[model samples]
Target chain A: MKLQVAIDRVDIPRAVEIIRQVAGTADVIEVGTSLTKEFGVRALGPLIEAADGTAVLGDIKTCDEGKYEFDLGFDCGFAYLTVMGSSSLGTLEVCYASAETHDGVMMIDLLECDEDRIEKISGFENAVYCLHTSIDSGATADPVGQVRAFKAKYPQIRRIAIAGGIKKDQLAGLAAEGVEITIMGSAITKADDIAAACAECKGLCG
Target chain B: MKLQVAIDRVDIPRAVEIIRQVAGTADVIEVGTSLTKEFGVRALGPLIEAADGTAVLGDIKTCDEGKYEFDLGFDCGFAYLTVMGSSSLGTLEVCYASAETHDGVMMIDLLECDEDRIEKISGFENAVYCLHTSIDSGATADPVGQVRAFKAKYPQIRRIAIAGGIKKDQLAGLAAEGVEITIMGSAITKADDIAAACAECKGLCG
Candidate 1:
């Protein structure tokens, strides 16, 4: 139901510019994994500042040393941080605890994870289980269908988010399906008018 | 057998100092995942310079967007970069290609992968399949046994590496088992005399 605009593969100055353009329209602005890995979480203060009062999520995609990575991201002013679902249960638990302690949210990226793995990592009441498709693997075909299936399989997971090449046309379906967050990367960020594109996407999500 | 000293949870200055201390003794000096996430790969030029041709590896741990992350890491002058085995096969393939194109090595970090997943991702001839134990999952109780079992199951994988709380006492067994690379973290980097500890571990590997 919320539009999350992801800014990626750009320098901090450009990322800050994009954040400023979309801050009023986007409910959440994601500092993509590329930015986090390229600039480090500590260096993202400018983008965070540009977001003003809008929520910011850092797609750190933590695979190990969860507490350290999560603490660092939260300390850097990220309201939401991501951890890989493929990480060990202990890693997931520590990340969840860190999020709770920091009063932030945790989004578990379910990229390349099977049902068995997902079933085991469920039950984090506050955690958002993201049904993500890998960029290399191409765009997700049917996000609405994917969310329907995921919800059916793991009905206990309350907070659901979907990401990977999300377009404006699919935002309504995702919102109708009750997806908590719909992440759009290049579609909104690379548009001719960044602010206009984000406003349209935000309107669609409603 | 080779001794790969991992430098983690430290700042750039301290990392450079540790690299200087262990450069002569360590076959490979790993700029640990913590450093890469905290400082970014581009900012590791000093650490790479400190290695002085001891073969520095950036534990970039590419999970998705493999080509971009791999290219960024390899371009940053890392002789080696890591990709997560839990990543999609497509991601793994792109990472492998990037490593090959960059004339660098790719180390697959098998942190929480199962047999079925491993079987699907094997056969990157130049890749070092690292049998890694999650730091959150406690230290590997028997690394030798773990390597032996891995080899028995996947003999096609020729280049093998092992990591996670590796101690001086276990180096001999790992060497005898013909592990290609043994990654030691705090045991070597956190020692009172980092250079001396690295020398002892390298001697044991031989």
Candidate 2:
């Protein structure tokens, strides 16, 4: 299991400070969708550099213009970029090809995606299918159960991730249920001692 | 019929200049999703200001963080903000409530959204349902047929907007089909004379 810390809705400079602070403690440092949209890809250098050899993931959440967004994202130094599972099959296909070209990674955000849609986009060999619960919809109460349900439906999806208001308490269960990466935002970033909070969560994932 | 001019993938200053140039001539001036993400809502302040008395639409394409993004967009002086139909229903609700509270408008970007999903979100009375074709999937060849089919399937939806490679020649047909708004981004913005092109398109809509 990996601990991915998502830093969101903050000023880029402030995010950079947080990124440096969390350096090696996080296996995956996510430049949240808010940051990408707010600053564009040009501002990702600091975050990528601050990762200190750890993987960098940009939550681009691209629904269209996949190749342009993906190419720009990869050029900006993300090991992984995301495409919406609900995007046109064309968008998902191009995103996959772009990621493969860069030898980077692609994570499909399954926010509000139905089973039929998921089935259509299920065959990306290197893509990680994320069981994302929307923040507005509130956190997933039983993430383990959600993952189980998702696995039962799309067992061909080899890599799986869970996100949205993930707490430290659910880490063990998520790991137990074979979730590859658990993404948490405010729970860790907004904590009193960010590094210590991240470390504790990383410890649990380990 | 309305003419929506979408400004995308351009720098903030240039977008502002173009918006200033197109102000009252365009029924709606769209700050494309790329701009919103690239420049953030703060950068949009002047562009919204440039709209003068004309309606400014921010294609924020809120895939998540509906309330925050919509509130930010509204506060930035946009008359309308967009939320993706592919987004979670809760995201749609949050955006709708925010738009209502601000006395603004919500445009649901139906990019890759299926009939079942559209059926579920067809209840927002004040929302404009857009029949979007993905840039990744290329343009819809038969805009008239697409609109006719969509209207027949979702007749309860009162207002309709169509986007994706809408060329100058199709404007008359789209208008005759009772399309509420015909969005032309590249066709107009990329024209030899943007304002002249916009005027021609608006002529057809009127």
Candidate 3:
């Protein structure tokens, strides 16, 4: 399991500082959707520089213009970029192709999507199908259970990631459930000792 | 009928120039999703300034963090911001509230949404329910037919907007269908003479 630490709602300099502290500990450093929308992907030179060889995932949450967003995100130094599962099939198809062309990763954010919708969008073999709980809707009470059911429902989806208010204590259970990536935001970044918290979560994932 | 010219896939300087030219011709000037993602809404000061008094609609297409996105967009001088109809019910609620609080407009992007979904999300009385055709899905063939069908299906939704490759010739038909806002992209912004194209479209809308 990979620990993807998400840095969100902070300015560029602060985000850079946090990324630098957690890059060595986290397998993938997520530039959260807020940062991408707030600062734009092109303006994240400092944040990208601080990743220090770790994968940087830009949560662009592309609902449309798939190829443009994917190409720009990858060009701006993101190893992975996210596209909304709610987007059109054509949009998803192009985004997946763009990811392949750039040799970058695509993560489909399955927020507010029903099982039927999920089943229909399951053809992206290379993309990570993220079982995300929306922030406004509140965190998932059972991250492990959510993953177990998602895996059973779409057993063909090999790469699974979970996000939304993920706490430190929930890390080990998600890791045990074989979730490919567990994304934590405020839990790790807002902790008193950000570095130690990230290290602990990484250790739990291991 | 209102002509909302969408400025997309262009950098800030070009966008500013386009807005300045069309500010008088168009009722609303949309800073498209591409520009918002590429240059951030906060950095659109020049475009907003050039709009003068024309309502600037930021196609933020916000799926979550409703209040945050809406507040920032309104503060950045956008009269309108978009929220995806595909977002969670909770997200829609907060976005509507944010719009009300900011005295701003919320345009709900109805991309890839089914009738049942639209039925459930049709309660926002003040919102403009935009029947958007995804760029990946290609241009809407019959803008008039699409709007007629949408209005017939959801009579409660009073404010209606339609977008996606809406051409100058199609403007009069869309206007006859009583579509409140007609969003044109490349047809206006990518024209040989942007100002003339926008004025012609505005004339057609009349």
Candidate 4:
């Protein structure tokens, strides 16, 4: 299990500061969707640089024109890029192909996708299928339970990541449930001692 | 009927030049999702200025954290912003409220939503319900007929917009079908003479 700290709603300098603080402590540092939209993927070179060798994921949340968006994100030095699971299958296929070609990772964000939709998009072997809860809908009540249910429903999906208001207390359960990545946003990034918070969360995930 | 010209896959200077050419002729000039992702919404001030008096819409395509994205887009001086219909109902509600508060319009992108999902999200009275076809899925074969079917099914949705590879020949039929907005991309933007193509399409719409 790996801890992915998502940095959102902050300017590039501040995002860079946070990345530098938590780079080695967190397994992956995510450039959140808000930062991507506010600053643009091309402008994220500083954040990418701040991460040093730690893997960086850009939560671009692509819905259409997948190849273009994926190519742009990877070109900007993102280790992983996200695409919406709600996007058309063709879009998903193109995004996956782009990821494969770029030798980067693709994380499919299943924000509002239903079971039938997920089942149809479950064939990507290397892609990480994320069970994401919308921020507007609030935090996931039982993330471990959610992962368990998701695993039971779609056992074929090997790479699983869970996100949306995840706290440190739930990291162990998520790891025990075989969650490949446990993404925490404000819980770790906005803490009083950001580095210590990330280290604690990473320790818990182990 | 309104002719909304979408400018996509071009750099900022090129986007500004295109806006200058077609601003007054097209009713709305869309800063397409590609531009928003590539250049960032905050950096679109030049494009907004180039539109002059014509409405400029930022295709932000908000899926989650609606208020934040909407506020950012609206604050950047976009007359309209888009939200995905596939978003959670809660996300949609916040986006609508943000648009209302900003005195801007919200265009709901119905890309991959089924009828049930559309019905569930159809209550936003002021929103322009866009019957969008994914670029990856190829062009819409019968846009006017698609609009007719959508209207027949969801009569409660008043402000209807259709997009995706719309050509000059389809504008009259879309207008006759009582479509509120007909969006064209490369057909007009990528044409040899963009201004003339826009003027001709505007003439066809009338």
Full ranking by DockQ: 4, 1, 3, 2
Interface RMSD of 4: 0.5
> Each candidate's lDDT (Cα)?
0.93, 0.87, 0.91, 0.94
lDDT by residue for model 2 over A47-141, one digit each (tens)? 88878888989988898888888888898789999989989889998999999999999999999887888899999988999988898888888
Please give the range of 10 consecutive residues that has the lowest summed lDDT in model 4 chain B.
B163-172
Model 4, C-alpha of B185: deviation from truth (Å): 0.8
What would the per-residue lDDT of candidate 3 be over residues B1-206, giving only the tens digit for each residue?
Answer: 99999989989988888998899889999998898898787788889899999999999999988888888888888999999999999999999998999899999999999999999999999999999999999999988899999999999999999998888788888888889999998888888999998888899987
lDDT of 3 by residue, A61-142 (tens): 9999998999899988899999999999999999999999999999999999998999999988889999899999999998
In candidate 2, which residue ranges exceed 4 Å CA deviation?
A: none
**lDDT per residue, candidate 2, B1-206, as tens digits?**
89999999888788877887678889999988777665566766778777888899988788999988888878878899989998889899999999999999999999987778899999999899999999998888999999999889988999899999988888888888889888989787777788888788888885
TM-score (0 to 1) for chain B of model 3: 0.98
Clashes of 2: 1
lDDT of 4 by residue, A17-71 (tens): 9999999889899999998898789998989899999999999999999999999
Sort by lDDT, top down from the best: 4, 1, 3, 2
User: Which candidate leads the pack in DockQ?
Assistant: 4
TM-score of chain A of 1: 0.99
Better of 3 and 4 by lDDT: 4
lDDT of 4 at A52: 97
